[model samples]
Target chain A: MFRYLVRRFLQMIMVFFATTFIVYALMYWTGGDPIQALAGEKPVNDVLRAQLTKEYGLDQPFLVRYWNYITDLLHGDLGNTLVGRPIKDVLADAWPITIQLAVIAIVVTILFGVTAGVIAGIRRGSIFDNTTLVLTLIVIGIPSVVLAPLAQYLFTIQWKIFPTTAGGDASLWDLLLPGIVLGSLSVATAMRLTRASVSENLRADFVRTARSKGMPGRRVIGIHVLRNSLIPIVTFLGVELGSLMAGAIVTEGVFNIPGVGYQLSKALTTEDTPLIIGIVSVLVVIFLVANLIVDLLYAVLDPRIRYE
Target chain B: MTDIHVSSPPTVGGGRHLLEVKDLFVEFHTRDGVARVINGVSYHLDPGETLAVLGESGSGKSVTAQAIMGILDMPPAKIPSGQILYKGENLLAMPEEKRRQVRGKEISMIFQDALSALNPVFPVGWQISETLRTRAGMSKKDALNRAVELMDLVKIPAARARIRDYPHQFSGGMRQRVMIAMALAMDPKVLIADEPTTALDVTVQAQIMDLLGDLRRDLNMGLILITHDLGVVADVADRIAVMYAGRIVEHADVRNVYKHPAHPYTEGLLDSIPRLDSKGTELATIKGLPPNLMRPPTGCAFHPRCKYAKAVCTTETPLSLDLGHGRTSACHFAKEMLDGTLR
Candidate 1:
């Protein structure tokens, strides 16, 4: 198991480098002149451009520039934005809000999605099953872009139940609307996956054996059916966590929340290459770590799946 | 056949059957319509006896066992009317809670596919101990200890070492043994083994049958062995019930049924067995498929498949005729068939 962990850690390092390199390359290829962006509408003289390029080390070759970025990253320097603000400070300010939103969104997704799925699966062919199926399909069909604003309008603008926008001082209650909106698609996906997996497990021979063993219906469904069904759900939730980070980008914009996604969006508009790389690199690391954790969770959920 | 050693008859406690099924009828509500899977099937089992239910696929043998175990799914499978009597109490009339208490404690079942029947995620020991923990209220430690003991009882070698292995880690034969160990953990009075050895090779089949026979004798439990293998029935079964299309066509002592089959279906089954003495001969096969339960024939469900089916067989359903010496055959010409005069 220790060997497995060590191996995963090595792989995570490789993925981290590969991800940062690709993002850095994409930004370099697509971005406008950082010096021009810094100068705004004021025309830049040749000496000023050269000086700006030299200061940022953008005058160096791509490989040299990347090597410098890696060395700086090793020393905990995340470079600076076009405005000369440290990318680290920007991320530090933004990360807490995104993490809060993502965590709450994930919790809601799992609680509501898994419960609805299990109930629907066990009571298959009943009205509850049919209704849940229809509702999930409807939720899945609507993209989050449309759903987010609609939810914002209903709960915040119209109902006046929640704040119109989540700011730094907003309470958990203020974040609830945006969190649900951010997790809406994931909830639908999780519910569908869970329902299908649970229904399939209900037909498993082991479930019949459990029933024959004098286990009560409730215990049988809980211990035998639900436990077995959780493997796929866990895997889905891991992938969903990664997407949730990406999803928060639009949701934060929609709700006017000053999270990492909101900062990343603004950075993208301004072609803030350093800030873009920082955010994407962080998201990539988070995604990889979530996947690694999911893999580890498999061992906990299923005894047959041993790491060694 | 000469190597076959029949165990001594079970000590029957004068008219007190351990388990009895009376006119049990099971139906399935499918898209086609209501399909009567088990049609008025009845049998009695006594402690320490092995009753082998022999039949082709879809003859309601497994369904009968499932119905008796109260494990049949309700919506698709509906027991219209029946009585599963255990210790003279109607199990069908008992509340579901009470019935559950009887399951895995007083009555247990071993399914055909052990790999699928055992939970893939849990260790074999955990699966075995789960019953002990839940039904008997044994502490985790005690239940695990009992699980090892039960595994040893089923003759799984190195029981202590292999107890932590999952179902997939074991071979087909070993998994069946694990399943048997789980069933026997509760010390049930009646154990229903549905095609217990069907998934095993011939050699392993014999070994499993021997293990079951030895366990039955040792525990004095009423064993209902569900299989279509006549060879297996000959080796261990005390009595055999031959079913055709959801109805028992013959029920008699194993020896008697082999010597002179009163039902045509039984005759066909016996003749179909390939023997060492009859090499290079075309194996006799019972012709035609088992009738679909959705729309069974009007009179006798087996008439289309029975070689000796007569004109009366087409229009009249034959009731079970009692032959002397605790034998019964559901055939109009059972007497002539028994007398060897039907031909």
Candidate 2:
């Protein structure tokens, strides 16, 4: 199992090298007049342009520059930002806020979404199931960008329950409003998936066997039903985590949370290649790691899966 | 096969029989209307006896078992009238919660597909110990111990080691054995095996049947073997109830049902069984599908498929006439057939 995981890690490194190479080739080298874009019409002569190109290794072929980039990344050198700050420093400052917000939303969605799903599945056609079905539909029907502001309007502005925009404080509640708003749609989708999965699992012969063996409804749900139902929920969680990371662009801007999305947005308008590349690399790693966790969890949630 | 090893089944069977279904009718309300799937079906079982509810598909065999377990798919399913008397108590009339209590404790059911029946995520032991912890209220340690014992009882090798294995780790037959062991854990009064071996290969099927027969004798528990295969039930059932289109067309000793079938539908079913003797001959078929219960024939439902169907067969539904010794058959010429007058 360890050997298989190590092999997979090696493969992931290969993927990382390939992606970084492509991103560099597509964004900077292949594009028109990168020197002028880099200098921003500062009116330098040929000598200064040549010096700048040599220093940044822009004169090298795309593949050669990519190799250097790969080697530097391996040694934890993410390169200096366009404005002279270290790219690593920019990423370090913003990664936490994103983690905090994503983790909070994920945990909340799992707790409520799965619980609601199990309840709805057991009672199948009851009013609770119907209500959850309606609520889930509505949640998935509208986009989070729309839902987030409306939730802020109704709950924050009108109800005075939560602050309208995120403040500088890193207290838990400072993140709650946007977290709930960001997670509400996922919560609805996750709950629907859980309910559908649980309901299907409950109708399985083993559930009847468990029930016939005198196991209670809850036992059937927890052990026999919900256990099988978790696969789809795990998948949805992974996707939602990724989207919320990128999607925090809107949420962070709205809530004034200076996370990765906020940084990426700022870098995009200024065409800061180093900062953009830095944030994108961090995001790719996060996405890959999240998927790895989910895949590993598959074996944990289902012991039938062998790692090798 | 001869050993009468007794099991102290925890079910309270009292002095009378363990279970008896009296005139049970299970109806399903579909888009068309309410259609009676099990109409006035009746059967009883003594301790340690295996009674096979034998028939073709759509013959109300499974529906009857599901109704007894009180887990029939609802909205469509309605009991209408019947008494599922488990140890002198009417289970059908009882409260659902009480019925639930009785299901796992006294009347456990093993489903057809063992692989799909168990939870894929949990360990086999966790799934097996479920009845022990949930119904018997055993401690986790006790439940775990019992689960291992139950696995061993089903002859699952390396019980302690393999308890942690998932459902996918076991083969189809092994999973079926696990299902059997789990069902037997609670020491039920009656084991309703709903087509237990249909999903397995012929050899595995025989092994599972043998295991079930051995368990029945050892536990001395009543067994309701529900299957559509006559060949599968021949070696196990003491008596057979041959059902057709939602009613029992013939009920007698296994020997009697095979040797002297009174109902034409029963004879057709027997004829439909491919004969090794009649090699190279076209296999006899029932000629038509079982009548759609949503809109059945006005008179005898089997008249369309029955070779011996008469003019009276198409005019009125036949009555269940008593043959003898609790044996009854629903056929117009049941008495004539018994007397050999029909010939």
The most accurate candidate by lDDT is 1
Model 1 Cα displacement at B7 (Å)? 33
Measured as a fraction from 0 to 1, the native contacts recovered by model 1 come to 0.81
Cα lDDT tens digits, model 2, B1-343, are 0112223342354455568888998889888787889888988888999999988788899989988888887877988888877767778777667777787678889999988887677788988887677667799899999999998888898999998888888999999999898888878879999999999999999999999999999999899999988888888999888888888888888998888888877777778788789999999877888888887887788888877678998999988889997678888888887777874
Q: Which ten residues in a row are the worst by lDDT in model 1 chain A?
A: A240-249
lDDT of 2: 0.81
For B1-343, candidate 1 gives per-residue lDDT tens digits of 0111223343256575778898899999988899999988999999999999999999999999998999988879999898887877778887888788888888999989999999998899999999888878899999999999999999999999998888989999999999999999888899999999988898999999999999999999999999988989898899999988888999999999999999999999999999999999899998999998898997888889887888899999999999988899999999999999996
Pairs of residues clashing in candidate 1? none
| Tens-digit lDDT track of model 1 for A59-78 | 89998988888888878898
TM-scores of the candidates in the order shown: 0.95, 0.91
